[model samples]
Target: MVAVLARFLVPLNSLLAAGGARVSAAAESGKARHPLHAMVAKELRLWVATPTYLMNTAVGPALALLAAVSAAVAGPQALASAANVPGVDHDALAGLVSAAFPWVLGLCVAMTPLSASSVSLEGSARWVAQTAPVPSAAIVRSKVAANLLVAVPASLVAGVIASLSLAGGPADAALMVAAPVSCGLLASCLGVLLDARRPRFDWASAYEPVKRSANVAICVGAGVAASFAGGGATLLAGPCAGIAASMAMAALSVLAWKAASRVSLQDR
Candidate 1:
């Protein structure tokens, strides 16, 4: 019986070894083919490892969605009345609705505290990524992917809420989703670009780079300015506004990512 068992054990070991080899090969193949996916996964894992960062990331979008829904229910007049300001007289209601969704979505994504400090978050170990053989484009793309991974889902939620609230038809609902998604994409690109250009390697705490950094202010300010412009375009373009605005944002996102890829990642 011992001799029979030993013979079987050798075959079993050989089978297991073959299976392991296949799995290892597949993993390496995947890594080689989709490096960006692996990098994005790493970025996401970093967020998860840091409970505070993860909580803030999830909470920001939730609050923004809550605010958006509240604003929708309250209506423009009630909002202005709450602040003792006159009702929104100039902006059309439909346009206001269109603008409000993207406004919140952009603000939420831009305020996520991920992209603006993505590189800086590396701290003293920042040299590892900067010194690696990976292309800068790949680095920026992974950061953008991780950012969109957080923001795009929230944008969809906001879009669905917009559609259920006031959208007239399928086209309207699509525009609602598309416009906010585009805003998220653009915000991610812009935030990454700003941080890549000016990474603050000197910081005592995470807050220094994540919240108090100049990039944070610039990102938030850009999001606000975009909301105003997007709101105006939605007001003026009537039915096609969302489509046009999204296209323009998409273009700008491409430009921003290109610029970011060119940035030199080194000390300071």
Candidate 2:
């Protein structure tokens, strides 16, 4: 009986030791990783692995490119004919469309997967995150960063193409660059805030939150309103108005992010 007990105890002790080593290694690695980097990695992995996210990210750029190519192929004659309509200067119309197109595309790109869907996708992970020492604010910021990572470059590409078509000088090019980036930031912050306000973790599909949620419509509406407002401002005030609008949107984004951070994980 004593021999049998010793044999059992020996294997049990070995198993416990191996488990302890693994736990220690994991803890050490966790400590070594920055919270923001880890969160961004996790979010990117989700975005890459998920079909809905891939579709959401790709659709905007694809549409923008297609429209741009079609417009370019149509030549100035088509545009000029349309510009012949009352109150539409061909140059101004071209510039307005050029500036507004990229901004709207960037806004849509940021709005798609980074907002309600992101929060809902976390689902039970929020519980795990809440139990961890990590701050919810950091998590939120990381999501915003991940969205910007995907969005800013796409927006920049579209904006540069549009700016070239406008034939505007350096200042117009600068406005185009700054405006989309600011719009992307605004969309990201708004997304997180909207999700925090009405997180829907019970969805059967990831696409539901991204495509079907009320927040999507709200965000899209806001984007449209902002684009119109910015275009109007640019019409009245010149390219500087675009810069001013970007600045204003960026300020609002910061404030919205701050408010989102304070929201309870229970809400997520």
Leading candidate by lDDT: 1
**Model 2 per-residue lDDT tens digits across residues 1-268:** 2344344555655655675576569878875767787678677766655656556655654554454455456544465566576787776666556555545544544445365467767765668666757777887887778877876777777666656665367767777667667777777788878877787778788777778888766766676676667667766677788789878988998998899888776434
- Give lDDT per model, in order: 0.70, 0.67
- Consecutive 10-residue window with the lowest summed lDDT within model 1: 1-10
**108-154, model 1: which lDDT tens digit per residue?**
65566468778878888887787867888888889989988888888
Candidate 1 root-mean-square deviation in Å = 11.6
lDDT of 2 at 166: 51
| lDDT, model 2 | 0.67
Model 1 score (lDDT): 0.70
Error of 2 at 209 (Å): 1.1
Which numbered prediction scores highest in TM-score against the true structure? 2
